[model samples]
Target: MARSLDLACRCAQLADELKAKDIIVLDLTRVTPEFDYFIIATGNSRRQLHAIAEEADTLMEKSGSARIGIEGYDSNAWILQDYGDVVLHAFDPASREMYDLERLWADATRVDWQAYLAEHA
Candidate 1:
């Protein structure tokens, strides 16, 4: 659980560094067994979304996390990077509003990403 939280927070930090908007870390451990957490964020454009996903992939690999799969890179609407325990969603504003993952997973707890990072640091 600690390792999963650390990786999710690190991914969120990377997205924030690249200026991804409304970055959030959702604790889905109790809600779903498929993934432990979800790091969701919005990008200003398709280019920015790609950039965020690319950086996230690199960072996850560097941290010894194996990427399970990636989807929607070409479409650039909603890109999903799956790292087994942690999954990242980089979406444009329109797609974000359209899917509304937050609302769909409303029962999941929102982890205080900054605090988690600081504590782990």
Candidate 2:
């Protein structure tokens, strides 16, 4: 697999480690050239969201995917981390429902990250 896709699935796996809810990775390769995947997860609370983001950032960087930037850390609604090819979004329930990214990017293929994680493990 491409490194980008691996990172994306790893992000999903990490999110699952932190007990994130409704985790999904959207394969955006066909949707746009801007990025390869989007790992979207809903945290139970702000602290959980922060933990998920921080851990993901550390893990990605340690794996050589330096973070380009992070946004919405101050907010309890959503936190977005950009690692060039892969972007992970940690959102609270309300914000996730409000944004409805899956519906917005309906064309993007939904990845079976859990299966990938199991195989990798």
Candidate with maximal lDDT? 1
| Residue 104 accuracy (lDDT) in model 2 | 92
Clashing pairs in 1: none
Model 2 C-alpha lDDT per residue in residues 1-121, reported as the tens digit of each score: 3788888999999899999999999999998999899999999999999999999989998999899999999998999999999999999999999999999999999999888768877
Per-residue error for 104 in candidate 1, Å, reads: 0.8
Whole-model lDDT per candidate: 0.93, 0.93
Question: lDDT per residue, candidate 1, 18-48, as tens digits?
Answer: 9999999999999999999999999999999
Q: After superposition, how far is residue 120 of candidate 1 from its true place, in Å?
A: 1.9
Best-matching candidate per TM-score: 1
